[model samples]
Target: MAVTGGRAPNQTDSDGRSELGKALRACRGAFIGVGIMSFMINLLYLNGSLFMLEVYDRVLPSRSVPTLVGLVVLAGGLYVAQGLLELIRSRILVRVGTSLDEALGGRIFESVIRLPLIAGGGGDGLQPLRDLDSVRSFLSGMGPSALFDLPWLPLYLAICFAFHTLLGLAALIGAVILIVITVLTEVLARNPLHEAMGLTVRRNALAAASRRNAEVVVAMGMTGHHTRHWSAVNDDYLAQSRRSSDLIGGLGTAAKVARMMLQSAMLGIGAYLVIHQEATGGIIIAGSILSARALAPVDLAIAHWKSFTAARQSWQRLNKLLMILPRQREVIQLQAPSRQVLVETISLVPPGSQRVVVAEMTFALEAGHGLGIVGPSGSGKSSLARALVGVWQPVRGKVRLDGAALDQWQPDSLGRHIGYLPQDVELFAGSIGQNICRFDPEADSQDIIAAAREAGVHELIVAMANGYDTQIGEGGHILSAGQAQRIALARALYGQPFLIVLDEPNSNLDAEGDEALTRAIRSARERGAVVVVIAHRPVAIEGVDLLLVMKDGRAQTFGPKETILGQILRPPPGPIKIAADGGVAKP
Candidate 1:
């Protein structure tokens, strides 16, 4: 059997696009637009240097007011155009980031929800959202602009060469030095940044877990212990962040200093050329400007080195995760389940283990029948219930409903026909009516009331302050355990599902609640829905027509309820005995 539910490694879609490629493709047009705008923006950068050259070479030499005024007008026009292009480029990038988030956010959440059911699917659940945010932040920020402008460095260098060969040589050498600094920044910060990101994810997950279980922690007096544990994790994250920041900050400082010195050195070289009568004063200042422009992209890259590494790592991690998730298949229309469940020697193992939880168990239940599965703790009753409801796929044999395999049916379609109440009932934050209606946007009010009445919670709900409109706090914490379980039962019974599996449905029920549960089961059976209840108490199983006794992951007995109960409760044969005092004796 497969160890986990993960897809094969390196899986791809029909068009052969990897998950990373698919995400990037969504922003391709914006990236290209940014590239074009960068080219225009860099070309306009020459307006300032050229204007300086014109002021020194022509306007000042001729002392002509008209010429200077014309140059000023031209420079203003170029600056205006450059600003407009920059604004457009920024807007496009922002749109690209938003679009990417919109495209992938829902898919990532769905993948997270499905991950636990798949084999080999183990990772921080919230990491994908963070990774997506990382990608979006980088794309919309100044980092991408630096990359877009990097290619123009060569053009700037060529301008310096046009002024004088020695000035060109100085600019080229400075560019090489700054490039080395950028590389060093990456090498030094990569590990520290990666470590810091991991710690942040762990810390966030820990904090969320602690908050979710706050009541228990406070009651158990574990608040101090958890606080100290979280503090240690935070300290580790801070240390790694400090290391990364220190390295990037050092490189940024060095790059800035080197760029300033390089400009000065180019000026010095230009001045020497002018002294030799090989270049003019106008060319000297323009050469220095060009040299600064040439190294600006490299400087920006080094300054934003941390964001680059984080984004790169996030991209890789997201790619690996998305690839491992199974590709969504085309939905096939199938008929609804007809309450005929055939469990043909089905076996179930835990998600990440080979140890069987339900072993080679075979049974069949027809419409209008109720099966009560009674077993000791750890006897696999819950596992069998999960298999029956398609939460856990069988490792061997098959579970067929209406002559079709459970896994073969479309999930949403199948879900509409299956009502499952796990041992631990968890209700989401919503109104009582909304939870009962399964949060369906188009849920009919009549059906909601019918389901509540059938589950025997309608009277209790109408007695509340807002009737069906009462708001339940997160996980239904505001309600008593019995209330939550009854509401959960109402949710399961909604839409009159053809098959219902209730695992320990009455675990938290009082006497009234127990009667309500039994009435619900009988009502469902009357509607010809096959009902399966896993129970520990005899009262909970009293209405069941069939009994299945499980022990040690195997079904010990499966037959009529009276026959099985009689056989189990029958007294063992023994030899008759007499009391030593001659009184009647019991054996």
Candidate 2:
């Protein structure tokens, strides 16, 4: 939100020690090296131009026309080469950025995945990470490019000073005055500009979130509501953009004034020198051209900086994601779990929610037991599944894995015992084989096919024209909801785990798909891995050992399904049907 003139004052060196820092440091070096080469090219170009000017004045009348044409061509070649080099330097920036992207991007993902745990769990992440991404992209794209232009001005002034101290003094004064005006205008517009940028980032995040959840908006017939929200936010951003534009225009005016002053200073000083027989018109003309050519990139940088400022905010946001502590660490241990997971007094709070969604929950699942989690929507069935796998840490209690706290179980160790399928099905835009072997890259094709058959997705995969090799579009657009879910189940099955946490595995499944999933769950149980399924419908959880009803953030009852269904979940489908710790049920 500091886009409204707020900035992280102490962030300079704190986040600067990561791979991003190393990449940016390398970028800084590239920028300096490019600037030096650019300066040399510019110097060569000027020398050639000046030579041509001198040739025209002193030798054109007496020289052969062909020789003069050759001189002109050579000078044009220098200018052409200079132009090409500038273009090349800018182009190389894209590659340099790509290289850095590959090396450091995972760290950004890690940061986002980790920081929420540090901030008291998932409730403080989603929005901040979105904002961070915006800032990081803008900054990384073009913010530091100003450095490329910053160097040439001083060097140009020094060159002018070398020829004549008096002329150099005037040039220096003129440049100083220009810089002062630039700084003054920037300061004057600082508050409004920053506020406008903050609003812009906010609006952008809203638009992005809206776009992501567009299906829900459309389904609820809340299109008008969101349209109005987006329009108002967009208008605010537009207004701020106009204000920034106006400030730039005003700065342009100031630059115009500075240029006029420069022109007058050069001419008047040159006239004074000529009258006293101390200087010539040629010197003045050369000085003016050199100065103008030298400041071209500065002028260009000024324009680019206006664009770069917006991008700087974006880069900052993106970099923030890289700073979040990942929910899952990269640590791995070959040692396996010593005991099954035990939960006591656990709670779940989603990012950005004010109330705790699930609270003070306790449970112990003996190895090989299938626990059924039944609840109404918002009763925290999905949250329980995530917490068991340590996706979101419990707010009030510890989840012990293998007789140790979940964190003590090495990062990869939990994965070996734990496989989770969230309520919504997600698939990569790749083949079935790729999705199945995501965790085990070295998994054999036969093993992948076996897991697929176990999940009841092998037949579907065979139906596709490319079979297992067929590409699944984004989120498996080409496949049905049931197919994607089964594929996800297959992926979890591909890697052997001691525990399986499935959130609403039967959610979008047809009667046949549900039966298939139930069979798969039976297989996991037979294999001696504990299975926890977030159940919605009253399907026969025949293979499950015990069922727990979750209501009002606590375990309403712990007993057989027959005991809780009549008491907890089988209540009338109206008025939330309260069954928390024996409250009077609502109809």
Candidate 3:
């Protein structure tokens, strides 16, 4: 099975857990503090019921202004304290959310960067980040407060029972009915909400892809087709959303109606007790207020049920992603590889794919050697280059650098020693100087200029209006294709990495750029760096002394460049004509 399906290498043996759970656990103290505040707030809520009771029973019969004022003053103070505690609890919860984000933001971003490498570039590529946002937003909302207030419902119910048993029984019945509605809402809304979430992800992915390829769609007159496709996806997403909303909304309205009916029933029961000489008239008003307060949390929870469900699903998805791509373990620091790059019978499959693109092929390149890989389209030259540069892992064999496996060193550490310029070069949104130095804050100006000169693009950069400080738009849109390729070459040559791999380095280059690329390759080999170039163009292989020819995912030839090229250029024992596209034909 492909790893993109979420079956990680250590799925069975490793414990399935996420840093999110750990981060939440770290905020246990804040949650406990919030719970304590909720308890106090609930205790203070009785002030309203008790004050009504005193005004109706004590102050009315006695008609004492002083007693009324005293009760009013005490209740007012308690209400202020309750409000303060509530504010503090809200702030604490917000800080807890912030703290959790701060703790996991870096780790989450690292996972996002590596996700494509492990799972292939599919989907929106922002799902994990969105999940974190959902979790944080839910934490910083009223949902958590409602959850915390739920435990105090029994206290209010017990107080109502102290006033009259009949009123307590009525409140209990109403609570039971509301609880059932809450459970039903959860069960019925789950599937619709889940489907809505999936539709949302798909819709967003489509929108993102369309925006990225707008130029293509417009140039090819495909705008209408893409718009209709997006519309269909949007319709499905909206339908799911409307279904979830209607379900939650209908249940929430029912909950509100049931709550009001229960309050009225409490009043009726209290009035009956008063008529039967079992309670005072004050009990009627007091019981109604108490019952409403008792069920308020459940009602609030139901109102925010959608948010709760979204947060729960987001948490689950994030947890699963983290489990699949756990934190990279700390490896022993190894010396910088210096001697040779050994490709020992490696077989490679693309990420998120089951088809092997490169079969078991083996080769070795010693220091001070430059090897060029030549192959037809779909011949796996690029895949082999990916394996050589540690971008793709071999399933069956090892890629060793000076006898140490690629995994022996940390990724960042290993990256510093390998320079790679892919066929399709993309520069970041930064200045030319920053791009060349790999955004190193402490990068020396001399080193940056040296790399540029080595790639033979220093004069072109200096001739620009901003010299090296010119901002390259996202994906280097500001530069021409040839200019971008040369800058990418400079970036690869930066810091003089020991192993350099360039795939189709001259695909977009002019004669000057091609000469610069060849010079850069020769310079790297002179510095004892092992260089590998994968190319289909003839000029790209001129600087290399060794050659490897690939065909049908297998190495068909490998040896000194002259020997391999001589055999390929030699004529067969058949009459043939050289085609205009540089191919021999038997006609």
> lDDT (CA) for every model shown?
0.88, 0.69, 0.89
Best of the candidates, lDDT: 3
User: Cα-based RMSD of the predictions, in order?
Assistant: 3.8, 7.3, 4.1
- The clash tally of candidate 2 reads 35
Ranking by lDDT: 3, 1, 2
- Looking at model 3, residue 253 earns an lDDT score of 97
Q: Model 1, range 414-527, lDDT digits (tens) per residue? A: 889999899989999999999999999999999999999989999999999999999998898889999999999999999999999999999999999999999999999999
Worst 10 residues of 3 by lDDT: 1-10
The global Cα lDDT (0 to 1) of model 3 is: 0.89
Q: Write the per-residue lDDT of candidate 3 for residues 433-469, one digit (tens) a residue.
A: 9999999999999999999999999999999999999
Q: Tell me the spans in candidate 3 whose CA falls farther than 4 Å from its real position.
A: 1-17, 574-587
Per-candidate total of colliding backbone pairs = 4, 35, 0
1 or 2, which is superior by lDDT? 1
Q: Considering only N, C-alpha and C atoms within 3 Å, which residue pairs clash in candidate 3?
A: none
What would the TM-scores of all predictions be? 0.93, 0.79, 0.94
